[model samples]
Target: MHTSAANELKSESLELLREYYQFPSAELRNRLVQLNLGLVRKEAHHWVNQCTESYEDLLQVGCMGLIRAIERFDIAKGHAFSSFAIPYIRGEIQHYLRDKGSPVRIPRRWQTLQHQATMLTRQLQVQLNRQPTDQEIAAALEISVAEWQEIKLAFRNRAPLSLDAPMHEDDDSSASLADLVPDNRYQSFQLAQEDRIRLQQALVQLEKRTREVLEFVFLYDLTQKETAERLGISAVTVSRRVKSGLKLLKKIMVGSSS
Candidate 1:
């Protein structure tokens, strides 16, 4: 609420932070967090321009940064907490913005490679006096040609997108990229064969009527009424069959799992 300025109490606050390490109390930790809100505000101001999120949201993220910094700070390191905590605070905000800003959730491995390859390319270009070749880039980055190609794809997907209305007020275009692009859902790389086997075993145990209901309701994605009409049964009968089938199916699966 009314914290002493971080600058004014640098030494005193550092001591308070070390005290936090000893006692490990949330009240003290929160008090330290309040005192260090200035750091969060300062870092939030710096990132406000680069990020598309509202300044208020950025500040909230920055406060998360501050809290993390407080949690991880070590008094035994003998460095100023400001110097130590700045990276954690900045990193927290950057990480939050990175996730918030990206339309695609790029895998962590690729994210690391993106940084590595970008940094490597810049260094190689300067060192070699030209743009690096795929061979040269791969060699320096210690990745094979196929891996390098996948890295290239990841770099493309990781590019930033703006949430602002796609078409400008003056534009007459009917379709934006959102209209043009198809959303891709993530697919598991492999089916669990054992699980599939277990499911089949479970399905085999269902009664003929119940299995038929399940097949129509799920495999064909038919409504209960439609399934009933197709099966020459009342909708209530179809509903009962489906309910009983799922219950039996769950029992079989649970037994199999155990």
Candidate 2:
């Protein structure tokens, strides 16, 4: 399907899903579910034809993705659930395919480097409360910085393997993390949440008066006149405090993150 047509369909589907989610009558939910199923089948049918996996299996995985998309969607953000859900659905299907196919054996040296990098990254984050710098990563992994850089360069050259490789013939629904790409968008959300938390914490560390001015002006959405009256200050004084408090808070947040 054309991107425009797909987006329009997704938007329409999200609207229907939102209405069903808000009201949550079984009849309405069932109707919407059926509608979504038809849409999933249409998309999945095209994909399944190109792969060895059964169409029914792909449909089942797609349904799981749809259910997840409905549950996680936030209407306040003004994003269509379908747009967010497509990647999730595709990931799940790709996972299924990888689990059912033959695996490519990665070379021992590359596997070791990959494992070391992952472990060092995790250890650095735990100790420093953030992702490690290149030097930190190298030190933690007991490698020279130059060697670490070379390993990273070499790792980038290899193409990633498929996730749909089966563990064994009998296993139908299991896939390894090796089969999946990290969702960079999800990583960005995690970083944003951490930054927001750090900022809020830094705000709490401000002087009581400064914090109060900020809360009154921003959190409570008060006008300068109302804030002045509440705090027994002139409007001019209130505006100055708000500005000073904001500048201080920004400094504090930046300092804490660094």
Candidate 3:
């Protein structure tokens, strides 16, 4: 799916979450969990190669964390759910690994500190208008520079260097570690799950016919002619709708972002 379409789905999930938050229900919670299962799978796979645990075991454990995040997430916090939930999901996997005597254990305190540091780094970058120095991050975390460095070093040591490690292919060409990982449909779906709330709301402002045309062409992945057939309009009309709809969406999205 195109990135925009994937973003649309994510926006829908967020809208559902908002509704679920206002009127808590077992069914809505279950649906929210189902919608976000990809996040669990992504985090679980992240640890799959880092430890000796089976993927299935890690996945089941990760789901528990996802459930906790769904229950605890505050829509009014103005934080992205994925950002808030990743720590929970990762914590669960890490706890499972530690409990089961995984060899690559990093202290829980250090791990928690590392997550705090990451969040602080972003805030500091914006405030400083540049990448924040390690000292600045350390201060924000209320830790000495040496302890912050130790936390960073320990977190690095916990994972094998694979994500961006260099590799050689059969033809002797070099590639990044990410290129070596399988880009399966599941990963594609995960990509689609990234948030794009502005675009989603902008789409909602479109006329119903235009919205339907865009959905059929983008979300449903249909050809312009096929979309026209389904909507009982001429192909030319579908093309016009697609163009005008996108123009309007871009305007709304850009204005909102600014």
Candidate 4:
């Protein structure tokens, strides 16, 4: 169907749904799905581009989520149905990708965590007007620091760097960076779960200022100058504190492992 026709159908369906939403009526439910099927197709297109698979399979999976969303939607919520339905549709597609669409399938649990992490990162990024620290995001989500690290790892797994894409230099004719770069995950860890927990525990033992300095430096990837500016301290102090915190964190991690 044409874009205009799909949009018109969506608008008409939403209007009907807003006025009369009957749970048991097959006709009403069917109409809503038929109209909103376009949404599923649209969202599936996004994944299909990234994924090497037939679009039809993903479209079918996304439609299942759209149907479920229609069944569960509450008109009284006073929210746009499109906004609410997109997540459901996206989640379904991602879940399907994790299961069968991708060669290296991640577990369903990690997939859900990664999805939550992405949404929370966006939310906190907007609220803070800068990238949020893992500590801040963890506090807001009320998840353990280790769990947040796991989410980050899971998110990284989904990110694929193209071998044909240029890396550093702007020159397009240069050799692709993939030849020089090794995609190794086993070297140390992209931050192991054990390390995170030990580090979190060590953080609690540090002085408040020391903990804050480390948070700014590592979690937010702030430089000594930026940390000093934000915390109203000298660069020397931020440097000293970060140095001390790292020493302590390293000791704690080693202790925990032993």
Candidate 5:
């Protein structure tokens, strides 16, 4: 399907669902039941090997979750339907795993360490406006820096692998995560070069007076009044010119993007 048509259909479906949910008529409820069942079936299909339960059994369990979500949904809370549905869906899936006694548990020590690390990182970021360093994380987690290092080392090769994350193909058609990470060193060098080129281009685009005003205000870190005095213009005129020049530059940049 064309992207536009698909988007339209999705929008229409959501609108219809919202209307049905609000009214809660028999017909609307039936439609919701069918949709919930279909969603369960679709999710079950993806977990055939991982799940010992039959698809029908999984579907029934998932429907219980779907009903709970529907009953608890509050339009006044201003959350999307999918956001509210996720917890219900995950709960159902987890219950299935627990019932089957899946042997995929993380080590208890690792789980404790992971929880502590995560909480510490979040707290540090809230306080410092940046991610915590290893030393800071260790202090927050009440562990020695060496112990923290050891814990990190243990999990270094055990990172959760996201199947959907992008990978790069080699010339011989092999893929790797190395290609997905931004080449920060190379990108920084390119960015510096690009900024220099853009500044030169902007200067060329501006009138001499405007360029001089910008140079004094930016490069020399002069106040608008100082820049205005240097250019023999009022501060207001200097401000207006700077604003106009910025708008022009923004247009140029946006145009380049397109």
Candidate 6:
């Protein structure tokens, strides 16, 4: 934004905040959120290079924080709204990344423990002439078994594995995470059955003559001449009914879904 536009917006925001402080209506709150949306976008942009989460997702989460800040802000305190609101926006995105295992926001204490655990493992390997078990590690660290387990689990799961990651470590193996996922036949069968039920329901909505014509031609897999003979109608009439009935069924199905 240009300097002049920034000044104008700051001026506008000040007046709106003063008005909102006194009136406290939904309309004023909405306007305040709109005027300050740039704050959310700015905070979200700061996280774009730091994590794998999409910018739009970060922006959406930051907007929630911005809304909370606006609702609780005290204009009487003389604090700059930008300064006050930035923490809320930044904290929300940090929390989202932490929960999503972005690995940057791991607690300082846990990070320290993880480092200690790594060093301790190498020492114990030489002393015992073998890898230390979880129990031995926890005892050596003077922490509970559960705490040691948690630390190990968090460190292991902190980063997402790409779907392109190899499923085998062999030099010539071509398998990947994507290839390991099972696409079973039962799920496909269920989807097909659901579609058949929908088609049957749509068929029931047709007029009696039209329904009979469709059932004979489609369900029985009969030719138009055979369908017409069964229905006692000319082949031309059967063709017309089939076309009109299909168009109406398409419309009815679309309307029902909507």
lDDT of 6 by residue, 1-258 (tens): 999999999889989989988888889888988999999998787567556889999999998878877876677756578866776776677668877887454466778988998899889978876556779888988899988876665554344323333312224234322232223653432222223334554566688899887666654445576567656788778877766776677775565456
Each model's TM-score? 0.38, 0.35, 0.42, 0.40, 0.35, 0.39
The top-ranked prediction according to TM-score is 3
lDDT of each: 0.61, 0.58, 0.67, 0.63, 0.56, 0.68
Candidate 3 clashing pairs? Answer: none
lDDT of 2 by residue, 1-258 (tens): 799986777777767767866776667655655656765776576456446667898899877766655664556546545455554565556556667882423457656976988887777667775546778877877778886775664454223322222222222224221112223554322222233334445555677777776665654445566566567777777766766676677666566556
Which candidate, 4 or 6, would have the higher lDDT against the true structure?
6
Per-candidate clash tally: 0, 8, 0, 0, 0, 0
lDDT of 5 at 158: 32
Error of 3 at 2 (Å): 2.5
TM-score head-to-head 3 vs 5, winner: 3
RMSD of each: 22.1, 19.7, 21.4, 18.4, 22.9, 24.5
Write the residue-wise lDDT of candidate 4 on 1-258 in tens digits. 799986787679778686556544667777777778878987776566556667998898988778766765666645567766776786677667767747534567767766777798788867776666778877877888877876664454365323333222123234332222223652432333223333444555577898888766655445566677667788778767765676676665565556
After superposing candidate 1 on the true structure, give the runs of residues whose Cα lies further than 4 Å from its correct spot: 1-7, 102-258
Residue 106 alpha-carbon offset, candidate 1, angstroms: 22
TM-score of decoy 2: 0.35
> Lowest lDDT 10-mer window, candidate 6?
188-197
lDDT of 5 by residue, 1-258 (tens): 599985765565466567866786667655666655555665555444344667677677777766666655555545555545544654566566666875333456756987889887778767875546779988877888987876664453233322122211112222222222224564422223233333434444567787776555544445576566556788778777666665665555454335
Error of model 1, residue 67, in angstroms? 1.6
The CA lDDT at 114 in model 4 is 65
Per lDDT, the best of the predicted structures is: 6
Give the clashing residue pairs of candidate 1, or none. Answer: none
